[model samples]
Target: MSSTTSNIKFNRRDFLRTSSLAGGGLLIGFNLFTACKPNAKPPVDLADLNYKDFNAFIKIAKNGAVTIFSPNPEIGQGVKTSMPMIIAEELDVAWDNVYVQQGDLDTENYTRQVAGGSQSIRFGWDALRQTGATAKQMLLNAAAAKWGVDVNELSVSEGIISNKAGETLGYGDVVEEAALLEVPGEVTLKDPKDYKIIGTDRKNVDIDKITTGKPLFGIDYKTEGMVYASVLRPPAFGQELESYDASDAKAVPGVIDVIEIGDKAKKLLAGEKVNWTAQLSPSAKVVVIAENTWAAMEGKKAVKAQWKFASPPESTEFHDKKLTELLDGKEFTTLRKDGDVQKAFAQADKVIERTYESPFLPHNCMEPMNFFAHVTDEKIHLVGPVQTPEDAANTVAELLGRDVADIHLEMTRMGGGFGRRLYGDFVYEAAEIADTLRKPVKMVSSREDDMTTGVYRPAIKYRIKAAIKNGELTGYYLKEAAINGNMYGLIPNFFPAGAVENYQVDVAKYDSNITTGAWRAPYTNFLAYAEQSFFDELAEEMGADKVQLRLDLLEKVKGTTDERIQYSPERMQGVIKKVVEKSGWGKQPEGTYQGFVAYYCHNTHVAEVADVQLENGVPVVKKVTCVVDCGIVVNPLGALNQIEGGIIDGIGHSMYGNYAFKEGMPEAKNYDRYRLIRMKEAPKVETYFMENELSPTGLGEPTLPPAGGAVANAIKAATGKRVYKQPFIQYDEIWKVAEKPVLG
Candidate 1:
């Protein structure tokens, strides 16, 4: 939980000058203070806003309208609205009085422009509120100076300022003067109890626009002179473009051009200044540009390209033998170590051992990948749904031989990001194609391309061993092996890390040519499924209550003076007991079986009870009672929606089974082959958050990690079977039944 992280400071920047409205109005160009970059520093003196290098534009119209620009990317995580709410709330403005606008990536002015890590709210929770409070204080200062009264004697409500003497001033009346006021070194924040908008149920700023199809997503983005383009990538991971004949592609009716994208094109533009070929790229592929999306698709299909397959030295195959060798290996890099684990296991009355595995899960975001870029001779303007636009812009600059100033990255709403958008390969490819064609280009990816050409979630295997002596847990050891990238690096010691007296966590890894990126909860998404399921098995082994055993471990952690425990044991116990009580843990409906699991991730503690029933051979989740404590919930409705979505997302993956790879290529290329939770299979999810004054954490990812285990344990309760691997739809196979469970 501890490492080198720069102290975050607010730095804001505006992409465009504050465009004035028709009537007399104030275009407030507030400076962004600290950058979002890790090494960025806070101002030496806090009293002045002029010292920082970021910008956020807020406008107040003569008609008393206010628009606050949101500085982070919105990838359907509800950040486009939730972030502005903190500002509006602290400003004491009516919910209806404020307008929300998504802003561009300004690294000098913003930190964490990307939306992964569930940090949209966590990243700027305080600075955003302070922004609103600062505005309010400035407005108050302006009104007081105009009225010849002390600021303390004046008060404001819903953008209206008043004095005891009955003088009144609208926010619009003083916005001009307020803009001139200096940002104070300090400002007073309202008490959590007095918050008018923080906990209130307000619609998303773009709800109406989204529901009516009036608002635009990245895939829906368009320009007057934009051309459509699609890339033809190699079928598998270890293949690159060798040669291609574009004659058939160019012969298509609306085909504009066939662009070859490779080391040659990149080196020609970037020269030796940048490692252009090593940067973000969809793949080394050929681009088919056309007048329409249909033409681009047809033209791409007609383009026949030969590929050079990677030799054994470059290829990675985890599905077969390599995984077994890595998992069964003894040598490892010790990440966390405590008391002697060997002695505890040797002396224990009982020793439990199990291995759990998860396959490479493609993001399979609802919207296929796309980015719109216009790289002309002068400046480069790239915009679309990228989770990390700032990084994308940097990559584009390296590829196009452009300056950061010349490159402008705008984030549009995304249908679903999951974690795929974090890599700007799509954006880079779009920029490359546009730069080559000398025109605006919208790069589109078919579902097949999206699934096939993914930095998929790394396939991981966990070997867990626990020692129990005289019916009491003693020691634990976990060796997690992952193919491809970093695992348990950011979060070490893990959950049971501090829960046990003698504990150790070791990591083993193997090289992979297949790319990998963060999926939902990443490690926790699979680790929790294994660890918590082991606890249930342990509960049965020790003759302890399933829910009581978790509470006991947390209670032990609470009493322990362990310095490594970063999470609060009280918080863990709070959610566990709350879920147990809420879900009627001891009394289940006659025909329904139940499962329990709890986990802490992304700084949120979540406990879930999945109530399920066996329909034929398939396990159907009937209802899920979820209790979460993510500090304070930002938006109850939105948080509930997130919890519901995550639980169902996990259930869908668990029941349908996730991605499978063969010959280093994903077998499930699209939804037809891939599986997702259908609406008919969705269980009713009841969600609740504990009352707390802690700054808001995140919820979108916490529920998902525990969902798979909860369902797996429930399947154990329904049919005394242990399903180790996820997509437990294969459970019936444990009995070697004539018919497998029908997932559909």
Candidate 2:
């Protein structure tokens, strides 16, 4: 891991300049593209308090209190904390003095304010560092000018500047002068080794709010003269609203109005290009508006609605059979083909193949889908917990036939996203409801509503085959069959691509009415389990250690066509080796079954080992060791929280999470039916971060992919039975005869 710095040049006109606050303070604005341009007018005039002019920003009060605006949505990924930490670190400010505030959607200043793909930290790194560095440089120059000393002779630490003569000044004392100084042309970034706040542990800035149940989540949003809306969506995926009688709903106490809103499909099917985010807006649904949430919910329950199939209804059974048939058929698209796989398999000594299957899954975010919208003739104001606020605003704008400039979106903390909030359909629906009533409305989705009528993780099947020749691995082929969509765009270039000489990847998809989109790591979530489990079997067939087998394959990938690879082989190997040493792989005590898996995705490399103990013949995950190489963790505490959360989430869903559809209706409406990992079942996680100078990648998703694989392998070691399907309890025989699990 090497440290790299951007040599950004900034002229007086293009530098990230400062402004005098309404109060006696300094407000610094940073824009990576235009703010640091060589020759251009500054994006924002340094005379006013205009916040929309910069992608990243810092405000220092005269009393030394610092406020940093986090430009990305905070979906429990800790960006609100980590993003500001970067600025505070470079600003040489005390961590205690820093206050982080979530910034509203300002496309004029921000780029990539999205929360998906685990890229918030990676993409915001350089600009955020430069923002603080630029501010600090200006402050240093101000102190130098006042003290009649060279800037190079001044040293600053935690908002205090000192000279060799022992004279000291607080940053507050010089902030006014700093605001008036011209921005430096170039600013130097601190070396990674000199970092103080980045590598050290820092608590989430919102931890207190979250734990204390403050009004930080979108579900907690409220406004005056606002009505609550509960919707009645079509029960089935292919169903369309035909007629609705709101007589009973209107009779309910506190009920105000019931209205039907048409789906965006009309515009979507017009054969005209429309906003992609708006395409996910809901189908025809009856909205019940009332004075309160309880009234709205009750009114919705009382409403009588009639639905008819727009097309053929789909079921899990139909999807499973169709996907299986697609796997056996010749109709497929070649995503990637490295060599002649057919020829390599022709003369093979042995061929092994396996198919893995997973059911569709709902996100089931803790805070059920909800958004507040105020629609008037002039503007549309939306406030919610959305991952892509910019996209949400655009989607609303498109759906309402309004200009994007007239839509303003504010982001509140999300209880959980897990890729669910990436779509702006809910936001659009809220705006539609409010626009129809010409008033402010807060739309809420019941747990059942979201579970049954929501964007889901598409059900998928993978057929993976490997051909061996003379004890050497020769060919590898993977065929993916999915409902609605295929693997993610970049997955074809992931692991085992550059490692195999005759590697090939093919995919086929069934266009179903069931809506599907990104779910956490997306395709890699289950693909990792399928591929890593297959690799374990491949290693066994080759009479090699599973861990060593991965290392050997990575060795072949290193330096050979490395540029095309999405992940670093060295980083992958580093985590693998670290997890092995830390977990004492192959040296576990008696009755302990250990499984190892290494994976790379979300621009991060991770290796995990699950330790299983059979409790009354049922495999119990007792502990897990996870080693990550995300590089220069901005906040070790937050990073640890993400790793543990990812692993636990992965294990929970892989073990008991099963959402089935029968005749286009979700089997489980809520947690009463859907199973989740219990507190007693959670494994004690030992987390370790591979120290490196490389820029940080993503931690929110990468660790999750390997968790399922490691746990499944551990169960196999414990029971000599392999599980190929998600919700492992359904496929493994040990779970069939085992008594109720009891915590050890």
Best by lDDT: 2
Model 1, 135: alpha-carbon shift in Å?
0.8
**Cα lDDT of model 2 by residue, 354-414, tens digit:** 9998889999899999999999999989999998787677667777788999988889999
Cand. 2 TM to true fold: 0.94
What is the lDDT, from 0 to 100, of the residue 580 in candidate 1? Answer: 92
lDDT of 1 by residue, 166-269 (tens): 98999989876665555554567777887888887767777888899974788888889999998998777777678889999999999988887765344634
Q: Per-model C-alpha lDDT, please?
A: 0.76, 0.84
* Runs with alpha carbons beyond 4 Å of true place in candidate 1: 1-57, 264-283, 313-320, 559-564, 731-744
Backbone clashes in model 2, listed as residue pairs: none
- Candidate 2 Cα deviation (angstroms), residue 282: 6.8
Worst 10 residues of 1 by lDDT: 43-52
Model 2 off-target regions past 4 Å?
Answer: 1-6, 11-18, 33-54, 263-265, 268-273, 279-282, 731-744
